[model samples]
Target: MKTDVTPATVRDWFSEQPAGKLFTMPTISAIFGVAPGDERRRLAEAVRCGYLCGFLERTETASGRAYRVSGKGMRRPTLEEGDRARRKAEARLARDDRKRRARGAPVSPNKSSRVRAARVSLRAANMPVPATAVQHSVCETVEQFLARGGRVQRLTAHWEQMEQAA
Candidate 1:
């Protein structure tokens, strides 16, 4: 039987291995509940915790995330510009949507310009197309980040920092 190698799949794999021994965010995301591409923040947190570095390499992909165990302080390559832009736009949409929901406001009908732009690019590529598909694409993008060891400090802390930075 072909086993499902999803976030849950990767999480199960890592959980089965051992705790506290440099598991990449992708593995954690696959098993855990985080979206892909969002793993960058998780990786940052792991880096803060001294758990990950160049050694624990992970990479984001169009479909999902992937990872492998590695030594301490291992620095893998960074995301390309296009990929980074895609991630940022998706994250912004997710954050804004969450905020809108929390405020008990009606959800916005149209996606942010960033998301629209991304959709346009995706469409131009002649990829299987869908108009309202940005949200799912964002989810997949977050999964990619997760695979690449993304991290998010608790959402509350993140919001506070954003407020202050703003």
Candidate 2:
């Protein structure tokens, strides 16, 4: 902490806030010449409870409280800007799609496709591949499955597999 942050100093900072700008907790504390060290938490509590500071309210989509100095910060984008952003985003996505096609990588469409993609990444990294599928004893007794079945094991076999991998 630089110096003792009094309520009067905080009130002055709030009064100096710009009209249309918003600030977070750390930002406000930094404005007060406070270093973000051991004393930062103290500053946060002070700002949250500084009843004199105005417009220190929590935004709906925001995690912590945001200090809005303007009339409810609308953030409405211009029509031309919105259209430009959409076009740029779509063009970039299309370029990425072309590159994927050039590389011959399959598109992940479902859960099984996601599994296949994961296996491909692992193989690329030179990791061991896992079993594709394993059968389990669904209706047979443990003794029957152990003696009669070929290689079907219990579901707890995953733990054994994990230990062996480790």
Candidate 3:
């Protein structure tokens, strides 16, 4: 029971155990002779790896969440399967990034760089510059008014009467 337990080890161990036997984190930790603290992180990682590799199944029981041997097969994942999984994950991430970009979400990690890029794009497109302080203050005032349940109405013909009164 070395501190470094690989997913393969977990899978092999579960394969030897009786099928349909549920195991909780504490029970697994105890079996592995590891404390349910910082030392248990490696065990947790191994458990997660076993789960992702389809050798372990997670289920919700009356006691709590538990893990059991999948019993599907005791075979290890092939290198090609791992490569396909990695490629799928990468493609998913790339697709999500594209979707976020299409929704006008910031792609740059740096806040200042995002702002700079936005400003540059705006200038390139001949769009209006960012709002001034006065414009921002007016927007804040309108937001506050709306928050306070105030209603804004269209003046329509009443504009002439207001001008005459002024």
Q: What is the C-alpha lDDT of each candidate?
A: 0.55, 0.63, 0.79
Worst 10 residues of 3 by lDDT: 132-141
lDDT of 3 by residue, 27-49 (tens): 88888788767668878888887
- Candidate 2 all-Cα RMSD: 22.7
- What is the per-residue lDDT of model 2 for residues 97-161, given as tens digits with 9 covering 90 to 100? 77887899854366877888899988888966687887866787767867986576447588798
Query: 1 or 3, which is superior by TM-score?
Result: 3
- Residue-level lDDT of model 1, residues 1-166, one tens digit each, is 1244333334335445543454444455444455556454564454333324343455555645445444343354445789979999999998998999899987765658569878889889987657773454324567677788997565568779999999
Ranking by lDDT: 3, 2, 1
Question: Which parts of model 3 have CA positions greater than 4 angstroms off?
Answer: 74-166
The C-alpha TM-scores of every prediction are: 0.25, 0.32, 0.45
Model with the higher lDDT, candidate 1 or 3: 3
